[model samples]
Target: MCVVPTVIGVMSGFFSLLPDLLPMILPSEVQITKASDLEAQRGGKDAPMIRQGAVIGKSDRMCATVLIAKPRCSSAVHHHGEQETIIYAASGKGMRHELSPGDFAFIPPWTEHQEINDTDENVVWILIRSGPEPVVVYLTGWGGDEAKADSID
Candidate 1:
């Protein structure tokens, strides 16, 4: 029996075309700069302002959103479905677990929780949750003021 080489094509032309077939990957530094530029364009001077970016509206799978919260800003005490979540601190400092960065606590389903940004700089974080859809019902604080009862329930 004749054995054939297991290797694919080793042509120089094919190798050179690899980059063309694949999209160029941007470094993290470049990505951070781009994000900063976008934020700068929409950023405004105001107290307790929220800049929601990405994954708005309704969807089936888990949703992802970026929340840019300013100082003294807080999201009222609320609870959602039996969905698990992880809030990642993207930048700046904040009081999540009544402490600094990497000090987050688990919030069980239907458990009421609120986040406040006490620092001067804006606190950016990613909210990730897996479920049918997130339905946050505000009981007290800022959520009680703006959101409708029907929307939350």
Candidate 2:
């Protein structure tokens, strides 16, 4: 028998508790990635305003990353094939109504959208996906590239 800690807030139901509690309840392994250990990566856009870092991935059924949207920048329109994405706004600007510290967005799989930061400050958010690997299918090409999303390998 094994015991696992419950995730107090944020998500709810079984899925919320599964990721962190899996190793405890089963014969699986758990891995933790410190904030200082993440490698900086582009936030799927050609602009410098958006940046991202992978928190946990590869060995798990899900992937988590932190996205930083700089002032006056907008990400190219894109979508993840069949992976649902949940975004938790940690800080910074909002698209419509004023978003507080803990506001979140549930993006359905294959939805096309873009993160626009019209404010003068950076907006930081946590992005959690439904799969271990990211499947980015850009609906609109970035940086004037003529390649279509469907043509990508």
Candidate 3:
């Protein structure tokens, strides 16, 4: 039945049906990402050059992404415009303020902060934002020039 599978977060793929059945049957609001279908990206060897770009997208209400933090590096002080971000530590624990595995943190809309990883390994964080797309406004520092806010990622 759907009870146990739903409770444990198992996406039930239909056994036999028309080729277009899934798209027609499943509600568009529900996004089921299978484990094997998920993609993960990590920082490359020999320290990656600082980069910024928006890849995460939204179906309608929220946008989600998997961010891998480089070792011994921190994100630029930035804000998410009107979007709120929820972060979950997936790997390489001990982020700033000491978030361990399975830990979660919330960032309000337009709140400026950085994700600092002091460890030697890449840190992975699952980010879910309360908006239809990712919006990143980079700044020179906290309360610094908003004009330098480039890349709405």
Candidate 4:
């Protein structure tokens, strides 16, 4: 006698974990943002005043940008409200609390800090911040007024 095989038993192995496998099996789109597409925005005087091209940009979860500090310049003391930041010295250097090229600093949320460039040449650094958005709150201190004066439009 011919017998009919059961569908449940045959398909159980393939569809039993449909929910768990759907996400992995789906296709995803990748975003590619070009450098020329980014808008040039000015960082606070004490911060690196960016010009020309942007290295990266703020995303829904993180922010990446390049800092271009002129000679004898330094970013004003500021803090990121809830975003932690990773700053890497990409080129040209001065002194960042004794930190130098190939070196990176981890800035915790709400930590006040500054980037100093006392050399005659410009200092370039890549600043990466983690959060839904990068929020900077400048701190007022001894040289706060001076920093404001140095700020560019």
Candidate 5:
């Protein structure tokens, strides 16, 4: 019998023993980034998907950014190593070809994906990753031959 699954299940459920403490935020520890102050961070040499407005970057286990996708734009193929991501469509019609505003999508670790906008309207998504910093590994193509470049720094 496989004991790995049993062990992992038990370990993952450890949080049930303790109460989730999100309501205990301290006033001094709260940090806010204004929309006008959002920084412009870049992606890979070939992948320019980042016209992003970074919000909660440098977190110990999460990074959040507002991504703006231009009309008729398709980003390079890439994957986040060991980091899962959750995307929330904040605005934009999303139309019939994309995620509508208020929609959400989750991407697992090491999953190869691309952000594509095939409509005439711009799309905006809030990207949140489970990592202190994003680990973008740009690829040549789907099921890429190998990594073209690794890590964003």
Candidate 6:
């Protein structure tokens, strides 16, 4: 079994037993951008056009991220071992195996899935995934950096 160290903190100056006690903070700002902006920056790169901030990595057992995607943008079908995920749509609408905002879906370990934005505007969401060094394997679709890809596979 893989042993993942954990850290616990107290309100009044805490001590961390693990090698690292990473703090997860809610972003204070949200910036909206168009698909055109992403296209200009990527130059046709097959990457998720992130219009806002996204949680790419975290040191904790669970990592939370926020992402904004323009219409028609989709995530690749992927799966991982010992990892589960929950996605909450904050705004806009989309389809994820018959799921949308105000709707919650639990992706089990090794389950193949992807996300798509069908609206003309942007779709915003909060995603949370848990596991020790959780690995996400992309089966199909597009958009991910080298580090992100390496972590998943």
Q: Under the 3 Å rule for N, CA and C atoms, how many clashes does model 2 have?
A: 0
lDDT of 5 by residue, 14-116 (tens): 6564444443542336677766665435443234244564745656789887777767777667788899999899876442336888999888999998888
Q: Each candidate's TM vs. the true structure?
A: 0.54, 0.64, 0.64, 0.62, 0.67, 0.52
lDDT of 2 by residue, 26-133 (tens): 865556766655543553555545545464556456788877767787666677779998888899866444555699898898777677778888788788888886
* Candidate 5 clashes between residue pairs 3 or more apart in a chain or in different chains: none
1-153 in candidate 3: lDDT tens per residue? 558867545443444454558768774675565544343232343443223223345354687776777788777777899998888888886445788889999989988888888889878788888766778788878797664534323
- Give the Å shift of residue 112 in candidate 6: 0.5
| TM-score winner, 2 or 5 | 5
Model 4: per-residue Cα lDDT over 1-153, one tens digit each: 433446656688678788679768994566565654544344345444553334234345676767777888776677777899888887777545755778888889977777778888777777788865457666565335323534533
* Residue 30 local lDDT, model 6: 47
Worst 10 residues of 4 by lDDT: 50-59
Provide the global lDDT of candidate 4 against the true structure: 0.66
Candidate achieving higher TM-score, 2 or 4: 2
Cα lDDT of model 6 by residue, 1-153, tens digit: 433332223422344422335323333354444555434544433445453224334335776555566777776666665788887877788756555667776788767767778768777777677853446577644333223555432
Better of 3 and 5 by TM-score: 5
Clashes of each: 0, 0, 1, 4, 0, 3
| Least accurate 10 contiguous residues by lDDT in model 2 | 1-10
Better of 4 and 6 by lDDT: 4
Q: Kindly report which residue stretches of model 4 are placed more than 4 angstroms away from their true locations once superposed.
A: 1-28, 37-48, 51-58, 142-153
Of candidates 4 and 3, the better by lDDT = 3
Model 4 RMSD vs true structure? 8.3
Question: Which portions of model 3 show Cα errors greater than 4 Å?
Answer: 1-26, 29-55, 147-153
Q: Which ten residues in a row have the lowest lDDT in candidate 6?
A: 3-12
lDDT of 1 by residue, 36-109 (tens): 65466465555364545444344456665566778777766676657776677777666446635454445577
